[model samples]
Target: MEEMIKLNSDISVFLYDVLTKRQEKNAKYSLRAFARDLGISPGRVSELLHGRRLPGRDLILRIADALKLSPLETEGLFRLVHRQKLVQKENGGARQLLADEYAMVADLECYGLLMLMETEGFKSDIEWIARRLNVTALRVQSILERLERLNLIRSRYGVYERLQHRVTSTHDTPSDVLKESHANVMKHAMEALYNVDLNLRDITSITIPADPDKLSQAKEEIRLFRRKMAKIMGSGKTREVYNLNIQLVPITK
Candidate 1:
């Protein structure tokens, strides 16, 4: 079962490889092209694509819009990159501090909160959040309550602040193991957020019938399709885009 999970994660990582390559190629033709469109810089664009650096929420939204990635796809990309880093660490790549226990901020809501915090630090009033997010104060309050309950943010003296900077466990775990666990958690979270109707049991059962060669072919096909979708959407011609935030998962059951 673990092996099968790893195989699926490997397949997902393969898709991300193609997507990143496509993004890089698109950026190569005109570093200024995306930068101009995004109101950033060629240097920043390079850093974002290759440096494994996290961009601010606004920049992420701008890039996502420029790339024409769907909200779900944007989220998926964040997850993929995060898993990639973990994979690298497992293979003797650079290491970083693990995150302490805190809230799980998934999807757009996470991005929204991060943006507000970045721009305005922390605030306790829902009105402030609503004004910033351009939503009703009631909605902002609900979001804040949810975020606090999730432990993603903490409220003190009516102001909400980010609890931690990282998400993965700091304890010792093999890099590969961390990557695998991260991938599974990300996929699960994404599916839940986007309501992706992936009948996992059905998929596993169906795949079980295929021969090794056929399964390999199918996996490649899926990877190619994901790549194509990513390429087409990331064309930098869209007006609206979503900001995908970073996520990390520990390698523990």
Candidate 2:
């Protein structure tokens, strides 16, 4: 049996190495079995190994998990895949995120799913997540799959975990998608205002004259404030999840 060697930047070679290592342990191992274990079709796996196709980020993560790669190896694989994506983009072959993908980023429930995973009482059950996020179990199921495809979350042995602490909508996201997300958040805030106990929630606002020229600086300050509050609230014995929404918009323009 050979020890795992240093993986090259080429995914094809890395995959070949994985296959060879498995064959060393079990001479009966077949390509179909390999593909099955990796959760990809045999033809697609062949294309990847033959360098006819590059693995997408989702496929890369799936392969990494199937191979049970070490943390360092997983990071290396991601770097390689990202470089490949850059090359594809430069070659005008890059696939942009589909509208559905953008919608996932713009879904406020998706953000709630991530945050809920951090709470002390978090459960991976769809019903539990649905209840916690105020969404239907079906919606929770859809968001879980979408988040996994985005590599923001992963499930292993029936336990789901957040790969990222937070995610922001990409700058390229359409205005309507962003607006939909913001509207959802605002709706939640409104509900909490009347339904939640005053001691358990805080909703405060202030309006002041502002300089439009310094709007960028003001945005940066807000970003920092959000991070500061996240750190403060995330510390010590977290039992619940909360969202902090801040709005900075002109009333008259």
Candidate 3:
């Protein structure tokens, strides 16, 4: 239990630092090589650093032994291992929790429900939310429950609050899940284009011939614009949910 109290607090940072330092010393050090040295699969190391998986006791000890950790680091590693056990016992481990959230996001209505929860006129009533979002009240209730379980949203006095306001996806999100989400969002946008009033919707697109080399810089520009929009929208005056999708693809053959 002493180890549990003295844990590293963030194993992701520790493993990333170790990988970086080792790469500095060994020019040819790849993620595969790093994982081999630590006696684990490259995929496992990737997942650990990405905050998708947690290591068990034996694997943690083996990693420490292979890294030839300092005495203090060994203590810290043991603590990390013990902490993982406790988290697993209490929350069914990181993978299970992430999987549940991923599955939740797979449902487009659930995704819309989260965004709708942020509107100033947000309603805690499932029937209201379902009617507003064009989904069933039962589904709205179920999605709210799932969101609460995943800690993505919290409830107090029956009002739902978004726990994580930053809208971002995991680095290692499944491709199919992302694709399906994109498809659903596209369908919604198409429907809105015809149904929503011009004063309430903004949809514009341009087709231009562009150099491929400049596309990377264009992407950076979009990223910066999105970040700026997020900050501007953070002023506590949010009254509506909007989707801003930027697309850059080849059209010239």
Which structure among the candidates has the greatest lDDT? 2
Among all windows of 10 consecutive residues in model 2, the one with the lowest summed lDDT is 1-10
TM-score, every prediction: 0.28, 0.62, 0.59
lDDT assessment of candidate 3: 0.70
- lDDT for position 198 in model 2: 100
Q: Which stretches of candidate 3 lie over 4 Å from their true place?
A: 1-100, 233-236
| Tens-digit lDDT track of model 1 for 149-184 | 434455544666664332333445445555654565
Candidate 1: residue 154 Cα off by (Å): 0.9
Instruction: Show pairs that collide, candidate 1.
Output: 66-236, 67-233, 67-234, 90-175, 103-151, 103-152, 124-158
Model 3 Cα lDDT, one tens digit per residue, 1-253: 2342243344654676577667779868888998898888999987776556667777777887887776677777777656655655554343232333575667668767887887778888888998887888888888888876555666656888774443344445678877887888788889989999999988899888788999889998998897688678756888766776666779777
State how far residue 251 of model 1 sits from its true place (Å): 36
Off by over 4 Å in 2: 1-100
Residue by residue across 22-127, what tens digits does model 2's lDDT show? 8889989988999999999999997776555888778877988888888777777878767656655553442233355668667677777877888897888999
lDDT (CA) per prediction: 0.49, 0.74, 0.70
Order of candidates by lDDT, top first? 2, 3, 1
Query: On lDDT, who's better, 1 or 3?
Result: 3
